[model samples]
Target: MVEIFGIAVSMDPIWLTLEVAGWTTLILLLLGTPLAWWMARLQSSSKIVLEALVALPLVLPPTVLGFYLLIILNPNGYVTEFLRLFGFEGQLTFSKTGLIVGSVFYSLPFAVQPLMHAFEAVPQKLLDAAATMRANAFDRFFTIAMPLSQRGFLVAATLTFAHTIGEFGVVLMLGGNVPGETRMVSIDIFDHVESLEYDQAHLLSAMMLIFSLCVLMLVYALNRRFGVKVG
Candidate 1:
């Protein structure tokens, strides 16, 4: 516990939040990159449907998403039953794993949209030139598309990490509030307020505000420095 303005505050939630954010960001980067790449290159009309599905979390209420996820991840849920067939009977809901799953879903758009735009922004002419050189799609993506999309990668990672850190509804609904396991910084602040610990809540909220502002500032600065136009 650390004393802030004479109030003892536990740091467990902060560390746990960072841990979850780290995992969520890593998983999104790995999974979203390929999905974004595929979506960006698709020429069919179905691309719109795919994009809408990927972007659903952006418009959907967090509680609604969380509620559905809870159903899917609970002890008697299909996911658990399927895992049991493979001798894995561990619970997901009310655990850190549930928090990570919910965060990944909630933050999917933040990762995918920017990456898709970046992949789209890669000049088709450049890809054509690479194709002329006998470079395969896999080689071209790694050597050309990925290098050109570095800025987008940075933005995606920053946004994903920050968004995960600030997650509340999904984490709350799926993981509940288990200290040192699933309790995130946002939930900790909420708890403080609910307990009438105004000083602690204010302190935590202020920290989050400052951190979010700094992340946005950094993203904008990098974009401007790299001559990337933001809409």
Candidate 2:
């Protein structure tokens, strides 16, 4: 819905942003937690290679990542080829699902690194003691490691969600500016600014700034309250 007389407003971008952010955070939580655990306990040289791949997005420019992702997600590329086997007939680009995939990769390190460090911080003696009691690796991980790494989960979830909201380049490149579809808050703000609609841009940008600040503050506060050091 477009507002001409400054009367009505639409919530499409907000909803899309939330939908992608929520699902991206959830996927990272489910995927990143175990990967972080594996990385934490890995002693082999291959671990370095895997860690580098996971962390590469952190240093890589968003446009660069988006460019490669767009290639892979193209109709003739690996992602679509694989999905075709499962009967999914559609393009990933300019869609909400594509945005989720891109966001997951772009925001991967934000979820993994914190949890990796947290998992690494778990005392080895704890595992040793659990082993002495015949506790399986699964048992020990759930009963000991995960319980102690609550701070990492909190930090990872918070950071990923916030980071996904602020993502502009990856979203723009991978998802494009399709309203009621992939056009998120960040992209909307960009469009507004490009068209010199400063008022609308400011309104959305301020909300993003405040939301990000609050998320970070909550992370620090929660960590402090639980005496959980994320570093």
Q: Specify the highest-TM-score model's number.
A: 1
Mark the 10 consecutive residues where model 2 has the least summed lDDT. 1-10
The global Cα lDDT (0 to 1) of model 2 is: 0.90
How does residue 216 of candidate 1 score in lDDT?
A: 92
What lDDT score is found at residue 18 in candidate 2? 95
lDDT (10s digit) by residue, model 2, range 1-231: 666357234578988999999999999999999999999999999999999999999889999999988998987888798999999988898888899999999999999998998899999999999999999999999999998899889889999999998898899889999989999998888888898878788778777889989998998998797663432
Off by over 4 Å in 1: 228-231
lDDT of 1 by residue, 105-151 (tens): 99999999989999999999999899999999998999889989988
Q: TM-scores across all candidates? A: 0.95, 0.93
- Model 1 residue 64 lDDT score: 96
lDDT of each: 0.92, 0.90
Candidate 2 TM-score to native: 0.93
TM-score of 1: 0.95
